[model samples]
Target: MEFIFLAAGLIMGLGAIGAAIGVGLLGSKLLESTARQPELGPMLQTKFFIVAGLIDAIPIIGVGIAMYLIFVVAA
Candidate 1:
């Protein structure tokens, strides 16, 4: 039904917004820390990448599900 497509769009949109906010805040803090501690830049960057992956995981899954719902289920 049309509702299914709407639900999929909401899921994808909300997930993207949440992920964007989380990553933006996290990266901002990480940059601030790196600026304060230049010597630890490498270590901070490594951890930032790890955390970025974790933060992105859920939204990526939501995108996949949304694609499935929009293309397969709704079709």
Candidate 2:
């Protein structure tokens, strides 16, 4: 039980790091695309928000599970 929880904690932390990097890279690309085609800025911004929401969802779930394991399961 302890090892499983420990591994999950490590994986969740690493996942958070990767998620942050992924969102940063995604925003960078979105900026470049918008700069290249200024007229499509609104469309790209909307799409970026959608992708950002998707990226956030996964990490949020991982964090919630991690918290539950640490606070509730370990108790």
Candidate 3:
């Protein structure tokens, strides 16, 4: 039972860390690209938001799975 909690924690923690790193790198590249081509800033911003949402979905899914483990499996 305790191990189930640990597993869920690990899943959520790692998922969050992975998403953070991905978004950080994505933002860094977006800034670099926009700086290099200011005229394309708007287009780059649009793409960045789309990709950011996709990146964020990873952690949201992780949270849902974690909840399932804690409530359904552990219970």
Candidate 4:
């Protein structure tokens, strides 16, 4: 039972860390690309937002699974 909690915590922690790194890199690359071509800035910004949402989904799914482990599986 205790291990279940540990597993859930690990899941959430790692998921958040991975997502943070992904978004950070994504933002940096976006900035770099926009700096290279100002005319494409708007189009790049649009694609950046779309990719960011997909990156964020990973952590959200992790949270859902963690919650299930804590509330349902551990119960």
Query: What are the candidates' C-alpha RMSDs?
Result: 1.5, 1.9, 0.5, 0.4
- Candidate 3 per-residue lDDT, tens place, 1-75, comes to 999999999999999999999999999999999999999999999999999999999999999999999999999
Tens digits of lDDT, candidate 1, 1-75? 899889998998999899999999999999999999999999999999999999899889998999899899988
Which ranking of candidates, highest lDDT first?
Answer: 3, 4, 1, 2
RMSD of 2: 1.9
For model 3, which pairs clash?
Answer: none
Better of 2 and 4 by TM-score: 4
User: Candidate 2, residue 69: CA error in Å?
Assistant: 2.7
**Candidate 4, clashing residue pairs?**
none
What TM-scores do the predictions have? 0.85, 0.80, 0.98, 0.98
- What would you estimate as the lDDT of candidate 1? 0.92
Model 2 agreement with the true structure over 17-64: per-residue lDDT tens digits:
888998999999999999999999999999999998999888788878
Q: After TM-score superposition, what is the CA distance of residue 64 in candidate 2 from its true location, in Å?
A: 2.2
Candidate 1, residue 5: lDDT:
89
User: If ranked by TM-score, best first, what sequence of candidates would result?
Assistant: 4, 3, 1, 2
Looking at model 1, which ten-residue stretch has the lowest summed lDDT? 51-60
Q: Candidate 4 lDDT, tens digit per residue, 6-73?
A: 99999999999999999999999999999999999999999999999999999999999999999999
Better of 3 and 4 by lDDT: 3
Supply candidate 3's per-residue lDDT for 22.
100
